[model samples]
Target: MSFFSKLFGGDKEAEKTALDLFKGLFGENAKKDDKPEDKPEETAQEDNTSAPADTGADTVSSGPSGDSWGDDMPAEDNQYRHEGAFWLYFEGIFDIEFAEYRYEKQVLTPFKRIVYTFYSGETKVLAVELMSERCSAYKFRNDCKKAGLAYTRFYIDHSGWWNTRSYVVRRMKEALN
Candidate 1:
């Protein structure tokens, strides 16, 4: 469905001209010297420019950011599961924070289902997994259909995640007073 393949790459002269046409059509905001091929090659193993995610793959890796993980996670309408996005939404949108409780491995179930128990003091909010990827969070939040996960970078040992737990405790203490 994308004509981008035909438009860019190979024949540097043609690519430059095509890019210029696009720049003129889209906007004049782009700087004059900014040509993709003009830049020095990066030393990194991976290409710096993004290649589109392969839709054919069963689970396109969320990679460093937590978007999808195997069959355990729901693939559609799952944006609230990302660690940064989930926490940011609560804090930025509602000024609310939920205290998290992580279990010590294999204690909860035999299946490799990973999740956390969310709470406000003694009251439990819900049990869910934080997944990565961008999807319609609205469906999960408002609709009858259930979903977990959102576009964000998160892992069990991510230090920022542990720090975020403190936000809820502080909120709880403030509420008590």
Candidate 2:
């Protein structure tokens, strides 16, 4: 309700004394029934039923990305680790080995290096490694240029656990073609 309506409306209850407003703002209402959270905060008991089930391992769902990563890379590995959003979105286009991939902090401080090796009927055609994170676009461009690839794009892997940003492993073919 608008301020004017509340102040001058037909409802008598809406006409509040200055003291009522003060008490509400300060949370100093005399009666305990004023607030729904009258009692102390309820904490879960140590019993298994009360407590949440804890799985030791942290896992993300195989990524279900809206991003059609690419159609260039053919489906060689029939048995992909997991079928994720990539499969459902572009099911007939291509087969991608989509899975719940957890980023491992490597020898290089924070960035997790992901490598993709392409094959044509058991013969290896290309193998690319996405390295060098957190640098400038110039740096990435330079890296891509140096590697002879046309472009580089950031593919977000949202499995489930954590929303890891700045991890770029998108199939360069997707955006270009």
Candidate 3:
């Protein structure tokens, strides 16, 4: 094990030398095997059972689904086109905070944008704040309806005024959709 132990004809070193000698005599690429530190690298075929992946640009398509992008937005939609930006934002919150919302479940979260919420077991809830007076509460409510989450509003006064608004959403129907 130790250098001193090996120098004194240790059993471990004797075993290693015998193995090396045998490998040198009959192993494939024996000349390469002379360097004891080197190991035979696995070919790609040996490493993966699946066929080689196609990486051509023409072959690959982008979106929420690798088959196509987000199904919510179509490929030809003018307002919501497939931009790489959405994927980056999607990947950022996915698994870390919003693992519940995935393709199979058909759940969406407001993580990258306004509110942050997801299905907690059976109940759907969201943590949302009204940032501006101009922002429509109805639009926010409809968004929550679309996602099947309860719409709970938390307001904070950032206009240097003293009116601060905050509350936890406890009601199933009133607070959420």
Candidate 4:
């Protein structure tokens, strides 16, 4: 099998192994099917689950638009909900020393937004932002370029679900080198 196929699970057995890994990490949240037979249904489910939660009236809102970090936000605000999957899939491929979340304050806007920085030893090798459906990653990409930093956006299932881990690993390796 091609390396891509092996990395991404070319056959049923390989696919089953990958699914098992995901299930071990995410439990019931990990999908069981190896095929895209129900992509539309999965997409709908993802859309509902991936959105930021409503804070209601009692709590102050915080995000790009709100005053506080917002409710149910990840420790790394820029981190996509599925980043743990990415880490689980790719950590074996790279010797990542550490990952950190950073905030960039917009001069024009009142919000301070988070972005991810990955380090290999002391060198900052990559910056990543996880974008939701309504958000675009262009600005983050541009910022990375201007700062001479390697960067990429991690979108949920940008490729097919089964292929995304391998695709992201390829992209990160390319960027790191």
Candidate 5:
């Protein structure tokens, strides 16, 4: 099962539930009744034709170098940048207190990593670790569970970032209220 399926539910079920939730939150137009078969199929010749060329003049680039969508950096380098961005995004959305806690692993050389814990007033509500890769997310989730904390891992990828942000914001609002 996918991480989302594990986090939410089964694939189709989670998608349907999310769709229903969005429809309810955004109103009726969010729900689509149209199916693919409703549209007329194009001939094989039409399918073979090349798609329209991009003019490129209207394209907006917002990445570090204004040439990509910000995923070109090495995963390790991007992790800290993504984590800071995630912090700013949440801080802007909600009125809450954030504390940074370090977990130190003892080896020949002690390894210390920072994790962000968010509080709704006096109650520690959520612990978040922003990871550059999906594998790290699973490890972080396990670590948080072992620590007996409410945890959510946000990945640096666009979809993962947005999905996690939405889920965390909803949960944080509920916890605060």
Candidate 6:
């Protein structure tokens, strides 16, 4: 079902039931404000002034650069798929890009889904919609479990998810080769 349909489908009862189950199992409050206000917010800031500057300008960092949509660096696990094609993993803000594919509408699906298609001059890539916010990670994991597709985590709150698809296209050389 489409996201809008699921959202406005008047199935609040089921959603509530699921939320209750999650709350019971993880002790996670369905609503953030439900937590006691006793925990004080930490205003601590780390002093990075002493940190050494990066000396390697030639090295490409693994995050979005310029206007490109995928990472310049292919994934470390190269044997699974896209032996030569560039790989980009999206996480956090990158998930926002996947929202485009969630709807059955005018926009094209994300390129990361079926990146192998690019190897043969096919630009189309399949995108699977994640139904639940709480389960998106699990859903994406399960989706990748069914073979022929590659999977990589974006690693939010850490380092990962490089964006630069245009670089991938250039590297692929479909326009010149």
| Selected candidate, larger lDDT, 4 vs 5 | 4
Clash pairs (backbone) in predicted model 5:
none
lDDT against the true structure, per candidate, is: 0.30, 0.29, 0.33, 0.41, 0.36, 0.29
Question: Residue 97, candidate 6: how far off, in angstroms?
Answer: 12
How many backbone overlaps does candidate 4 show? 2
In order of appearance, the predictions have TM-scores of 0.19, 0.23, 0.25, 0.39, 0.33, 0.21
Model 2: clashing residue pairs? 64-85
A best-first ranking of the candidates according to their lDDT comes to: 4, 5, 3, 1, 2, 6
| Candidate 1 lDDT, 29-128, residue by residue in tens | 3344544222221110011123233223223223333222232222222222322323343343223333243222111211112334444456544433
Candidate 5 overall lDDT versus native: 0.36
Off by over 4 Å in 4: 1-114, 157-163
Which 10 residues in a row give candidate 4 its minimum summed lDDT? Answer: 38-47
**Steric collisions counted per model:** 8, 1, 4, 2, 0, 5
Angstrom error of the Cα, residue 49, model 3: value is: 64
Task: Find the candidate with the highest lDDT and give its number.
Answer: 4
Which pairs of residues clash in candidate 1, taking residues 3 or more apart in a chain or in different chains?
66-132, 67-132, 67-133, 79-150, 81-149, 81-150, 82-150, 133-151
Task: Output candidate 1 Cα RMSD.
Answer: 19.2
How well is each residue in 65-137 modelled by candidate 3, as lDDT tens digits?
2111111221222111212232232334334444554322221322112454555665556544322222444
Maximum-TM-score candidate: 4
lDDT of 1 at 31: 41
- Per-residue lDDT of 107-129 in model 2, one digit per residue for the tens? 22122233344444564333333
Give the Cα-based TM-score of candidate 1 against the true structure. Answer: 0.19
Q: Could you tell me how far off, in angstroms, the CA of residue 10 lies in candidate 4 after the best superposition?
A: 45
What lDDT score goes with residue 141 in model 5? Answer: 59
